[model samples]
Target chain A: DAGVTQSPTHLIKTRGQHVTLRCSPISGHKSVSWYQQVLGQGPQFIFQYYEKEERGRGNFPDRFSARQFPNYSSELNVNALLLGDSALYLCASSAYGGSGNTIYFGEGSWLTVV
Target chain B: QKEVEQDPGPLSVPEGAIVSLNCTYSNSAFQYFMWYRQYSRKGPELLMYTYSSGNKEDGRFTAQVDKSSKYISLFIRDSQPSDSATYLCAQRLVGNEKLTFGTGTRLTIIP
Candidate 1:
C-alpha cells in the first residue's frame, strides 16, 4: 500500500516570506498530523486533523496553520518565516480507531528559511 | 523535565556488537512507548512499540519498559552498519493518540 506522501521534497524561503507544505495520507486513513524536526532533534508535534476538524495543536505560534481536505490530504502553512523555521516537516496518518497508535509517516519536506 | 528524555549520543560501536539505548519519562500516565529509527534526512520509522510495562522482542531488537521507574530500553543485538542511524524514544497515554518524543541518539555501527 502507498504510505503517507509529502511535497515538495525541499524548499527555500526568505525571512518574512511564507511557505506551504502538503501531505496525502495513506488510503483508508482519515487522520493526519504534522510535525517539525530540527536538525539533530526529534519530531515535535504541530497539528492534527481528523474528519476535517482540528483535533490537536502544538506549542507553535499563530504563524503556523493547517487544514485537511475532503480527500484526507493536508496542507501546512507557515507565515513570516524566520531563520529558526528551517527544519524538516513531517506528516503522519493513521486510522481513527483504537489502532490510531500505529501511525505511518512520510519522508517529510525540508524547508530552509534564510 | 520533558516527558521523555534520551541521551543525544553520536555513539560508535563495532559491527556485531550489542547496543543498548534508553529513555526516561516523567509522565506516569504514559502507557504506550515506542522506539523509532531514522536515517539521515528521513522521517522516523517505527521500530518497536509496547504498551504499559513489559517486554517485546523482534529479530535483533528487544524493547523493555518499566513503568515503576518510568524507564524504557531498546536493545539491538548483532548490530550492523545498516543500523547506523538515529533512534528516538517516544511515549504517550493510551488512547490519547499523541506522542512525546526524545532528542534522539545517533548510532554508528562501524563495519
Candidate 2:
C-alpha cells in the first residue's frame, strides 16, 4: 500500500504570501498530523486531525492552520508567510489519534520563502 | 531546557565500525522512545521504537530506553555506508499525540 503522500514536493513563495500544502494519508489510516522541520533541527509538530476534527495542535502561531477531509486527507495552510517559515512541511499518518500507533511520514513538501 | 537533547554530531566513522547515538529527555512521563533515520531532502523514516525501559533490536539496529535515567540510545552494528544519514531521537508521553524530538545527530559511515 502507498504511504502518506504529499503534493508540490517543492515550491518557492514570497514573504507575506500564502501557501497551502496537501497530503493524502495511507488508505486505512484515520489520523493525519503536520510537522515543520527547519534546516538543522528535527521536525516540530504543527497540527493533527482525526475523523475530520482537530485533535492536537503544537506551538505554532495562528497563521498556521490545517483541516482533514472525509477521506482522511489533509491540507496545511500558512498565511502571511515569513522567511522564517521556509522549511520542509511533513505530513504523517497513523491508524488513530491515540497513542501506541506507529506514525508514518511522507516525503514532505519543501517550501522556500524569499 | 528543551524536552529532549542530542549531541548533533556530524559523527564520522569507518563502514565496519559500530556507531552509537543517544538522547536525554527531561520528562519522565515520556513512555515511548523512537529513532528515525532521515536522508537529505527526504522525510524521516522510523528506524526503531521502544516503550518504557529495555532494549529492542531489529537487524543491525538496536534501540534502548532507560526510563530511570531518562536516556535513550540507538546503536548500529557493522555499519554500512548506506547508514549515513541524520539520526533523530524522539519521545512521546503515554497520552500525548505529539512527539518531542532532539536536534538530531548527523552520522556518516565512510567506505
Candidate 3:
C-alpha cells in the first residue's frame, strides 16, 4: 500500500511568484496535514484537513493556504513567495485528527525561492 | 522558552554502540510523547510513541518518558550504520491543536 504520496518532488520560483504542492493520502485515511521544514530546523505545522473540512491551521501568513479534496487529496498553495519560503514542504496523513494523532509522512517537496 | 527543547547534536557513534537521545519539555500537561527518525532526503518515520510516563521497548529501540521531569528519551541498542538519521522529539498537551517539536538531533553510526 502506498503511504502518502506527493508530487513535484522539487520546485523553484522567483520572488512574488506562486507555487502549489500536492499530496494524496494513504488509502482509507481521512486526515491530511502540511508542514514546512526549514534548513537545520524541525518541521512547522501549516494546515490540517479532515474529511475535506479545515480542522486546524498554523501561524503561517495568508500567503499559505490548503484544502483537502473529497478523495482525501490535498494541495498547499503559497503566494508572494520570499527567499525565506525555500524549504521542504511535507505532507502527512492520518486515520483521523484527535488527541491521539500518529501521522504518516511523505517524502517532502523541496521548494527553492529566488 | 520553547515548549520542547532538544540538543541539536551531530552525534557520531560507532556501530554496535548503544545510543541515547533525549528531549525536555516545559509543558506539564503534555500527555503524548513521540520520537521520529528522518533520513537525509526522506520524511520522518515514527520510531516510538508513548503515552504518560513510562518506557516502551520495540526490537532495538527503547523509548522512555518521565513526566515528573518533563523529559523523554530514545535509546538505540546495538546501533547500526543504517541508524544514521535525524531524531526529533514531539509533545502535545491534550488541548493543543498541533504537535510541538524540538530541533532534531543528527545521529551517525560508523562502522
For candidate 2, write residues B1-111 as lDDT tens digits.
Answer: 999999998999999999999999999888989999999999999999888999999999999998889989999999999999999999887866688889999999999
lDDT of 3 by residue, A1-114 (tens): 998999899978999999999999999888888999998899999998988888889899999999888899999999999999999999988887465767789999999999
- The runs of at least 3 residues in candidate 2 whose Cα sits more than 4 Å from the true structure, single-residue gaps closed, are A97-99
lDDT (Cα, tens digit) per residue for candidate 1, span A5-72 = 99999999999999999999999999999999999888999999999999899999999999999999
Task: Point out the worst 10-residue segment of candidate 2 chain A by lDDT.
Answer: A94-103
Q: Assess each prediction's global lDDT (C-alpha) against the native.
A: 0.93, 0.94, 0.91
Write candidate 3's Cα lDDT for B21-105 as tens digits: 9999998988989999999988989899898999999999999999998889999999999999999998866744467789999
Residue pairs clashing in model 3 are none
Q: Which ten residues in a row have the lowest lDDT in candidate 3 chain A?
A: A95-104
TM-score (2 decimals) of chain A in model 1: 0.97
Q: Candidate 1: where is the Cα deviation over 4 Å?
A: none
lDDT of 3 at B71: 88
The fnat of each candidate, in order, is 0.62, 0.71, 0.60
Model 2 is docked with a DockQ of 0.76
TM-score of each: 0.98, 0.98, 0.96
CAPRI class of candidate 2: medium
